[model samples]
Target chain A: MDLRDLWAESLAGMLARPVRSALTTLGTVLGITTLVVTLGIAATAGNQIVGRFDELLATSVTVDVPPSSRGPLVSWDAPGELRRLRGVVSATALAQNEESSNLVVTANNLLDPTRVFGQTLAVVAAGPNLPETTHGRLLAGRFYDAGHVARHDRVVVLGEQAAAMLGITRLDHAPAVFINDRAYTVIGIIGDLRRERVLASAVLVPPTLGPDFGLKDVTRVLVATQLGAAELIARQAPLALSPSNVGELQVIAPAGPRRARDGAQDDVNGMFLILGLVSLVVGAVGIANVTLVTVMERVAEIGLRRALGAGRRHIAGQFLLESSLIGLTGGVIGASLGMAAVVGVAAVRQWTPVLDIRLALAAPVAGALVGLLAGLYPALRAARMEPVDALR
Target chain B: MPEPVIELTGVCREFPSDPPVRALSDVDLRVEPGDYLAIVGPSGSGKSTLLNILGLLDRPSSGSYRLDGVETTELRDGARTRLRGARIGFVFQSFHLLPHRTVVENVMLAEVYGPHPRRGRRARAEQALEQVGMGHRTGFAPGRLSGGERQRVAIARALMARPALLLCDEPTGNLDSRNTEAILDLFDGLRAQGLTILVITHEDGVSARAGRRVRIGDGLLTEQG
Candidate 1:
């Protein structure tokens, strides 16, 4: 018979043993599902990491003296030292003070001591491009202008969530807030920060707000490095800092959010790739076993067909078609289930489930290949059956 | 101007068993077009081997055989299969219709694998079934048919190819007397239609209906009628 008839007959025979066929296809499904899930999660996490890197730092470094080290406060005179280093473009020391208390955020409202930070307006080199609030206004005033910081004015900016919590909608009205039981007038709200790895919540105030919190000491030194040297600059900070103050020194690098997150993402992707490959191999083996059994079970029928004038290619095509169908079916079902699982998990954990082409395409192609390889031995065996012995 | 449909001379076949049995020895036979022949032999008399060689399903160890003037002994496997599909039709003792197919489907199977595989096989299969008095049972599965009805389907299948030689290897071996008579009557009708028929059997009833009988014993032909 022609190849089409052979395929029809073989498929009919396969359907005759529905349990066996389903069991055979299960191996491929497991393989493809593992592959899809592994690749999907890895890809999503990679995208998030890369997105975070791009958001946080295009090219800059921040240095901190951590609490673990015993440090007498080093003078903020290192701006010149940092400029002398290779690839150093510019530098500044930014001090931040945070104070928390139940405060009158609106006419009739009080807000919890969500984080409040103060920095020099000059230290925010990127202006509104830097992390800013996304919601209600820091009304009745403006952001910390150079004049406000120079005068040490009692001004505040509300964050998006902070502003929403305060129930303030009018930008023209000044709202009063209490920090460390001291009253400050709300000026401008920073709106929303870029949705990155960096904190998306906080209120911004002038460095003049420093003494309000106990942070009369230097909080952070924001250093701007030349493009492409941020990572190198971050690496060299510990060595250049005074040796005796090692305990109080920490280097924070603001890399292009995408690049920093990409590094971590590679590891996750690599892990999932290994998981996917292992399962695919197992799936291929399972398919091979099932196909071999199928060939053996239909030995007599194969012989009869051959004797009746079926060509060797016809026999091989029949088996290949059967296995490929099984693989394709399993791949479709498994991928759909995998996507559902990803969505379910993301919903439970409160994260975006990233869907992309690589994950979507890899499963069926890989599964189909596995099935073809699995069918290879069985198809060859069927093709090689001697019509004489087979007919017997 | 019609050609001799089958010719064999000094044909020998050896089976490589534990004792190395010789299944056929120096067999010489010929059948003209429209000949009706019966090959009669007891068990182990090499009748099956001779039938297989004649059917082009097996090659003789040392023989020069011609099928419709072509030297079949030297033909390659593909050429032999082509010849078999084009020129030979088989009816086995067990009435080996594919168990899953209906009567018409089984009959159409021959056309599916034959040299000139028929298109629109349904119409041709129905016609063939009618020729064997099985047209009404064409839709029934072989499992659902009686033994006699199944044999009729097998005969229909054989006739579907319209081969020059119809080979029957113990066609009535598995049937009751009524089924045997029915099959014999069908054979009588085919012979009248001028198809070359060879029926292999050890039963006298099978040989009596044939125009000629050839008896094989100890791998040798001893009598001809």
Candidate 2:
């Protein structure tokens, strides 16, 4: 018989008992559904969580430069040399004056001792690129530039929180804050520090004016590199800053976002792959059991067909087609349900759903293959039955 | 020079019991077109075995079988099936229609296993049902039909292939005497139209309807009419 007719007959046989067919197909549906859901959520969650990680932590590197007792571990011109390196967005040296560690910082020169506006805030000496390295924005005037540092103009920038605490808003008046008894003019307010959020409440100044307030050596070198460039910059930062004592400086660079994303996807898929496979095994078993029962139940019919003219191959082919069609139907239904579940989850969580189209496309084919393999033993058994024996 | 529809020479069947029981031995039988023959015997006689060998359902332990001028003893499994399907149709006493299929679908099942299967098989099946006087019950499942009606549908299924030989094994065993007479009338009508038919039965009344009668006893064949 032609393949079209053979397939139609097999389909009619399956349709004869609708409830049994539906029950047999359920196992495959659950298997395919689990597979799709696991993969969908893995891709979506990985895309979302890693995207933010790439933006905030993955692109920033911090190097702690220890004081050398007699001389600075890094020179003031180190940032200039490092900026010429590839992928270096900004590099700034941060240091604190030794004597100002215990001094109270204030924004207003109020004579009354009972009131405190800007106190216990850290005062830091920085190079020109402090705002860029921290991924912060100026809410008021521009940050004190190289010109100010070169001129030793004693200019300072207040962090957003520091300015709020001290009641210093607009830099149109050029407000000045005091550390102990010394005054430094505030030229700008830095806000939105993505990395190193503690800097949003500090008082920032150019390093040229730091020695007078007892500042000695650079303590921290904050570096912001381009996306996916943190690893290389982390390896090279200490060497570039201190040619002889690279080991003394500690470079703290978070892992790359691409790596984190891949790792996350792999982890999620690894865990769920087992569940998918277990479900598929259960499905295969169901197909095998049901197909065997069908063969047993239809012994007389099979024998009569054999007597009429059906060959072994024809008998085997009919049963195999019967199972594969069941699997394909289950796979189609399961895939749609899984995709809907993933989209629903993403919608609830406010994430952009990421789906791999190839996975969806392959599921039905996989299910069909599973059905074919599952039907192999039963079909062979049916085909091998002798017409005389079956009829008896 | 017309070829006989069935030709059997020295056919034997041995059931491998502890003491190998010989069901048939050196049996030779021939039936040409328009022949209506019946083989009858009591239980443990070789009538069923002779019928099985003739129907191509069982291979003889030794000897040759030719159905419609083709040597079947040496034919491969698939070729034998095609030869049998094209040349032979069977009707069992129990009316072996698939319990789930409608009468029309049951008849079309023969066409499904035919050499060139296609979509227009329904028309041929309907025509076969009409020939068997079962056209009115085409849409009914076998369970819904009475014994007589189900036997008619089975006959329709048998005739759908246009086989040269209609092999009936106890076709009237489960029928009432009236239904048996009716089925025998249908068989007579079919034989009158030039088809070779073989009936295997244990009842003398059933064997009396055939044009020629043969009795099998203890694996031996003897012509009775």
Candidate 3:
């Protein structure tokens, strides 16, 4: 039997029973829709998590004084020790003090007080070569030049959100802020980071004042590693600075955009595959049931066709085609619904749901397979029907 | 042209009832190409039984039946099915046209089973409908047609395969006289085209139109005319 004719006749027969055929396909569509929506939502959540990894500095190692540790953990010694480690490029100690924190002003009118790190600005002597904030950038004032760092200038630059919040709207205008009841002038405002949690609240401080404002020692040390050596550097720092007082010191290798993109891609892809499989199974069951009923209802017709010279293969082909058509139609509807659901849910949840190429490739394949699997039993039964008994 | 299209020798069909009823007994019959034969009997007298056997729809308990020179009793189920599909066309009294299909589609079903694939089945089906003067009613569903019209469509469907033998079981049992005559006329025309036709009926008028008539009573061949 030519498969084409079988397909034609089967489709025509199904169209003849529009209501039953439509209802049968509806089952598959619902199944596919559920699969798509579930996968899409999961993928969206996964992408967000991966993106958050960068903001939290997944590759950066944190050194903190644990309450259980015996020694005085806060000090300027950690940065120097960490910098000497094999992969470490440079290390800067950061201390937070409520007083002596003043807003820094540059040639621009931008003013930022909270940017003060309350330490010797010597770290700024590293100049622009210092690591750029992945989540934000300097917009107006030049970062503390070598002169400003050597002199321990009380200048600071505000992040874009902080500057805007502080009403430092004009480029040449210096805005002032109150820090721990002390007033400081804003020097300049920085722009957005590659990834930022809250843009409007930020500060740039120097690497000293470890003992000032109740800060007995350095609370945090920002360490930059050589290119491609972030992970290696993070790994070596703990052993090099093995101090008993460090609390929950974690090593994080800050990942770039590529890693985040790959993670998002993987999550979206995996979910779509799972959803595709689920939809296909449901479609197959529907197809099988429909074919079985079709065989039962058309027993006499089958008999007549056989008596007219149709072989078992012919009968099988016809029924198989019918089921395949149902599957294909359901697949199309399911795919469309799936995409829509993803978009809709993303919009509602305020998430970005990416469309993965793998999902696009899987929908049709799943639909077709379901059709074939579902039709197998019914086609066999139709082929085996007795011409004599069937006509009765 | 000289050979008999259907031949039977000592054909006996039995149904396992409480007493194992015999539906056909020692039936010997022959029909040349173009012959119109009618078998008439009461409901339980085995007329339908003979039709079923001749249609290759059922096997006789013990008998050697030949159709178009093939010994049917020795054939496998698949072979028998193929033979039945290729050689036999049935027109039931009830005109069992699929209710969901259009008249043309019903006729096309015959071509679907014919030697041709489904590709050319439609044209043959339409041609068969035209033969029965049902060309215009091709789009109408069987449920929408009258009893006579439905039977004609069934006849067209039977003819669509161009079978060597046409088996009609009470073709006019459900039709009025005028519709009955129309069917009988079509049978006559088909017979003139050198087709072997076997019709089973209780109606005397239907039997009278055949070239030869046989009577069965209680599963036994009783007479011939």
Fnat of each candidate: 0.35, 0.85, 0.59
Minimal lDDT window, size 10, model 3 chain B: B111-120
After the best TM-score superposition of candidate 1, give how far the Cα of residue B92 lies from its true spot, in angstroms: 1.8
Instruction: Give the alpha carbon lDDT tens digit for every residue of A1-392 in model 2.
Output: 77887898789888889899899988888889889999999999999988888787888899988777758888877877888779898999888755655457877677777666557877778888888788889999989888998898978888888788888898887788887767888889999976867777778878987786677578888888888888999999988988888889999999777777888889889878789889888998999899999999988888888977899999999999998888887788778888998999999999899989998998888788778888999899999998877876
Q: Give RMSD (Å) of candidate 3 vs. truth.
A: 6.3
Error of 2 at B209 (Å): 2.7
TM-score top scorer: 2
Minimum summed lDDT over a 10-residue window in model 3 chain A is located at A119-128
Q: Write one digit per residue (lDDT tens) for candidate 3, span A250-296.
A: 55456664576566657666766666566557667777887898889
Instruction: Estimate every model's Cα lDDT from 0 to 1.
Output: 0.71, 0.86, 0.70
Q: Which tens-of-lDDT digit does each residue in A256-330 have in candidate 1?
A: 555655676677767766776777777778878888887887776675566456667777888887887777777
Q: How far off is residue A28 in model 2, in Å?
A: 2.5
For all candidates, state DockQ relative to the true structure.
0.40, 0.77, 0.49
Instruction: Give stretches of model 3 more than 4 Å off.
Output: A59-92, A96-131, A151-186, A189-219, A224-233, A237-294, A348-350, A364-384, B117-122
Write down the TM-score of every candidate.
Answer: 0.75, 0.93, 0.78
Q: Could you give the candidate ranking by lDDT, starting with the highest?
A: 2, 1, 3
